[model samples]
Target: MKTAKIHLILSCLFIFSILSCNQKKEQKIETTSISQPEMVLDLLDLQANNKLGKDTLVTIVNDPVYHKAKKYKAVSASLLVKTEIELNKIDSKNTKIVFECVDGYKPEMPLELFLNANPFLAFEDVDAPKGSKWEPILKEGNEMNAEPFYIVYPSISEKDSRYKWPYNLVKIYLEPLNKSTLELYPLKNKKLETGYTLFKNQCLTCHSINGIGGTMGPELNYPKSVTEYWKENELVNYIVNPASFRNKVKMPTLGITKQQSQEIVDYLKYMSENKKKI
Candidate 1:
């Protein structure tokens, strides 16, 4: 009888071990599935069966990013927003469209700009040479793929002063602007405040000051900016002509006057003084 009991006990232990292993395997599979979600481009098409999928495609001609005027097949952002507004009866009076990228770069612009900008969601590149040297590969250390969705404005040049093109484009948020913050307009100097306005028009779209602007570029003031590292004179020169100083500075010259450049520098200094160290 004791020998029989020992055999039964061993069999029970073996079954318990197998059950535990199976549970762990199931849990791992579940976690892996939820980690990387597939990105989707929404256009608010109520009639379309696919809603905001790749079904609704538009054509973009003469794309300047590639050489030789390549053609791109994309989705018209203007059409999507218009349709959504009409279909769902959305109030676009004080609307602000936020373009969100996969790299956490969000730039919110007015709804009028969204309509006038003529932005599109480019997916497949047509008329592109396979062996061409101008293929859209990774530029910086960014690993995010610009495939499936790339925000492109055909009319605007890549070298334009207001060139705020975002690649690896993911989602779009439409909301109303109803809040005022210290960083929104920053502390303005009564006499030299044109620098502040210039900074808002040019730099504020990309670079953030005291955690209150776009997320694509680096933060300027919190922990100490380029001003703290580089000398004042050198920083001024770099701002005026970026490529002359460094081979390929991402920032482009805005053609601001010497007085304006100094104003922007002074504004940076002002932020640094008021910056709360992070």
Candidate 2:
């Protein structure tokens, strides 16, 4: 009788332990499933809006798509806002937003955005010169004017003023008139032709996109390969300050303003998306 009772007690304890362990494991998994996507999206949103936040740190684990992309010079990732809350928040902030990307596994320094409370409603970094500011401006009746903000990196020297890097930063400004403006001055073929004309006159000797142009540096047409993994803001940040990522990259800072860079980005996006033989 005593032996039978002892065995029964041992069996009950073992069953209870197993059930408790299983329950804890299940809870952990559920928590991770809910939290991981939100964290990733938040990081992307912060980068897209050029908003400075410390929550952007992400630990890279292996994913099949990321690994496969590593084989090629460029890789693309899908950006899905997993929850309604996340989607609503992003939508409320800016209607025109760029998705996040990264440049493979090369860890770049975190970009900073500081909000100034004084005469300028702008954001600046500590490294920029004193008194230089970036302001978010808009005409009174425009809704988008309240959405996107610009950053101005102060110039250290007179020559640097001509280069875009010192004042270059990713901007997510809303332009409600952009579409109508494009329609009024249709540049579907014209912009590329004109942009290319401008490129040849100004940039052909040193930089190349397709088969033509200079060979001093890597081609910008397939930036996804070179910066395939870079987040959208990181790419802009890199353009703003190349030395921030690479010490020996030879591309000179062209003093390209936020608007000019966007045009260049649009041109690049066009070429990459429509690689039709022309």
Candidate 3:
């Protein structure tokens, strides 16, 4: 009876030791996951170091910038991201991928959505003249090209506004998805959410209010709100079609209706009163 008790106790102790080690390993993994840092990729730095991975041929039909079907020497952006970032280490649903451009154009999309789609990073334009890597695109008589990098998706339609196609790309940032929403959301005036939503979806990428958005265009708030100087009616009209107000206008003719423009204007007026010195 004594010998039998010893054998059973020894087996129990062995099983307990295994369970304890497993529990410790799980705890360590959880800690590592919780402590993972934000992922930011410097595309130029990666290119200079030859760490951008393999380059492949990608064709973008109806290229939005070029406004024509074009081909490019590119790399798989999603794969590059996967290789550079440990997706398992981050909560993708709660995270976002922000594309920072040379002109300070920052556009972001949900990390989960970006990963699920076939996004490519185009490094060179295949159709450029033999001596040149990219052809100069004339916009507002300003010459530009998708040099260095341009994000494209072969499968996605150009009309899809949910996705952002940023050219002159420089950096990629992995941040909290709600980062902008938290900063720009109007908590005091819930009724003005429609206008706020319009501004967030359409205008925030190019313009900023109180310095919380892209600096590609002039700041709408802070030192003096655009609402303070420009007449409200004219401002609404200009928002709909900037070319109507000025020549060689850098702002594109966004297809926003007059009513939508007014809503955005209203939201800006609201923000004018709530300006934070940024």
Candidate 4:
């Protein structure tokens, strides 16, 4: 009888040990995922597999790209995101939603803000002519269309500066909100805050300071900064109106004042001195 009890106790203890270790292992994995959560979604891939969720119709009173009222066949962007991943596993406040366009123009907004709004991924123009999915958009002497995908919001104001309407969008990324700020910030000079803010708002989407921005535009500070070659006054003027300096210039008129342009140039000059090889 004593021998049988000893064997039973040993087996019970072994089983309990295994269960405890497994529980600890699961807790460790959960903690790791929450600590450094990042997700990249190839929108095209998702669409190809018919995983984009239900389609619906959405209207934009004044589309920023087309400059007119527009209607499109779209899917609820927030719902797609919510279904793809566990939102509760990550901290929305510390994260951002980046829309990656085909032209390499990457624009991002706070993840919490994006989720709160009624955003949509438009896949087709409801008013487009027969045999076509999109209408031509003429801007900066270039003719293009918002093919594949475009991010839009139905209730958001067209003039709301806080929202971003990115056409030709191809991918979506959820990343740490402060990833760029940690690298591109001008920590040495407090007076350069104005320029930094302007860059973050207007330029960072296209241009990078030290290989840390969108690839749509040239890197501003790695091999050579624009300020190093162009005259300060001329650089400012060029930024305010790129079309004035060159024929069929790809860079659009940012509509910022000459002073704002100068502020951006000043920030660029500062970054030129603080170049990181990568």
Question: Residue 88 in model 3: shift from native, Å?
Answer: 2.3
Superposed Cα deviation of residue 170, candidate 1 (Å): 2.3
How accurate locally is residue 264 in candidate 2, as Cα lDDT from 0 to 100? 48
Please report, in order, the local distance difference test score of every candidate based on alpha carbons.
0.62, 0.36, 0.88, 0.89
In the range 33-146, model 1's lDDT, one tens digit per residue, is: 333231122422232445443434444454443334555667676776665444133345565666677655666666676678777766656644585322454444333345
Compute the lDDT of residue 204 as modeled in candidate 2: 43
Q: Which stretches of candidate 2 lie over 4 Å from their true place?
A: 1-198, 222-229, 276-278
lDDT of 2 by residue, 150-202 (tens): 22222122233221211122222221212212322225656665444444434
- Which structure among the candidates has the greatest TM-score? 4
Q: What would you estimate as the lDDT of candidate 1?
A: 0.62
Question: What's the lDDT for residue 15 in model 4?
Answer: 99
Question: Which ranges in model 4 have alpha carbons more than 4 Å from their true place?
Answer: 1-17, 28-38
Query: What's the lDDT for residue 14 in model 4?
Result: 99
Candidate 4 C-alpha lDDT tens digits along 2-113: 9999999999999999999999999998776555333777899999999999999998998988889999999999999998767888878898988889988989999989
